[model samples]
Target: MSTIDVVEVQPPALWEAKRTKQRTVVWQEFGLLGIFTDQKPKIKQDGICSQQLLSTTEKSGVMDSVGVPGPEEYEEQHVHEVYEQIASHFSSTRYKPWPIVESFLQSLVPGAIGLDVGCGNGKYLTVNREVFIVGSDRSTNLVKIASQHQPHAAIVADTLSLPHQAGRFDFAISIAVVHHLSTPERRKEAVQEILRCLNAEGKALLYVWALEQKTSRRGWDEGHEQDVMVPWVMKTGKKNPNEDGSMEKTFQRYYHLYRSGELEADIAAVGGKLIDSGYEKDNWWAIFQR
Candidate 1:
């Protein structure tokens, strides 16, 4: 079993870890995605914030055919660690909010308290200032950048084990997040967690990569392996070019592309009532209520 230890840090950085041996698996070099920045909350690098320590088994991020690590360990390497390493670069490219997600936020009522459960760089947190949002992500680095968004908060947290109370949030969004889990059971569990955070009438939006995007650049469509490793190439500065004159290092992250009806199926499996759902820009999105 994995345990999370919440430690309060007081320093030049709020909730920042200062070299702790809490990770069951040490940080490893890997390529992953990033998120955004805007707004300035009452931040204090010298103030107090909380850090969560996730203890899970170790696994290399490399793809292999045999002896595959469990979902927790696999995600730790292929997902969380990669995001931490590429937070800045990832955030730089992720500024634009998806139209579907943007519309969802704009539709919310004023003063609505919500959660962005896998809230990378917190680009959505900027969508509706009339309402309040608490964003959470597994990457501490991303959370720090996301924390800059004002009238909102960001914290280091995992989708499967959020720090918020159940049935408390008015709404929630977990965009482009559930696809990162390596197993069907884990993906369903992720949906359950999202629904768990909602009030009786609260709605949650979720997005996942679609398997039927033949028109997209990746040209992935039906019949392609749903479970696959996608590569992210991070370009280092010109000062670090390799002999091939390429200054890029590629890292692979695992994704389980959702076919049509899959997102709704997962929501239904977890006893959530589907409010709305559709595909947009190579992803399947759904809004559901608990």
Candidate 2:
């Protein structure tokens, strides 16, 4: 097996070491810290970018109201920034549409206008050209790829604060998006944001990673930590020993695995009436209406 293609669990020691390593690369690469190595590092994938989008030598030092790292700050460092960096590689592996989400999109009526909250790479955008869909995500790079679907649109926007007007969309889908929120409040607010865009009778379908995915390779069970960092290992397929000789890199993305019935509880908390809900493919999905 090629060293670059190998996908194994990262050793805890090495992972911690890399996590706290000196930020030799400019702090602006991700606005906080980054690592540049002169040699290739072993890559590992715990589960599931090409440019320094923003660059500077100093830290951004962005913090929440309390002056310490809060939910937004934590997500920016672990979720948003990581997605921006690995958008290309992440998009490549996410082309296959989940069966449930596909059916949801296909079932939409023609001429219907909908929102795809956190539509990474907009794979579902191609599902139904007959219905107009506006896909939005926080990562600009992923939005760029999502915009390639004709007749559909993608924009860079946070899930917690969507730009659309209230109660305008016919439907909305937030597959694999809510799990990225680092805290319960943020996650519920994200669901509320989706519901806010729906008409009084409009519906929304949301999916989140499940904490009970014991059969999966990750083996996350009920007792496992619900809030954790999952690594996405990308093989760049190029070697540049002279500069940053990183043939591969691993990014840690934040996720809050939903336990059984947790998704329904969130919907209820957001005042959304649950229409239908189920578990599929290591994920919890719920279709609800406002």
Q: In TM-score terms, which candidate is top?
A: 2
Each candidate structure's TM-score, on Cα atoms with residue i matched to residue i, is 0.76, 0.77
What lDDT would candidate 1 get against the real structure? 0.75
Runs in model 1 deviating more than 4 A are: 1-68, 243-245
Put down candidate 2 lDDT per residue, 112-229, tens digits, no spaces. Answer: 9999999999999999999999999999999999999989999999888899999999999999999988667888999999989999879899999998886776656786556655
Question: How many Å off is the CA of 164 in candidate 1?
Answer: 0.9
lDDT of 1 by residue, 1-290 (tens): 13211212111111112322222111112222221112121222333111223323242221233443456876888789889888899999999999999999999999999999889899998999999999999999999999999999999988999998999999999999999987778899999998888999899999999999867655567865576555567887799886777677666566788999999999999999999999999999999999
User: Distance from true position, residue 226, model 1, in Å?
Assistant: 0.3
lDDT of 1 at 113: 95
**CA lDDT scores, all candidates in order:** 0.75, 0.75
Clash pairs detected, candidate 2: 49-85, 49-86
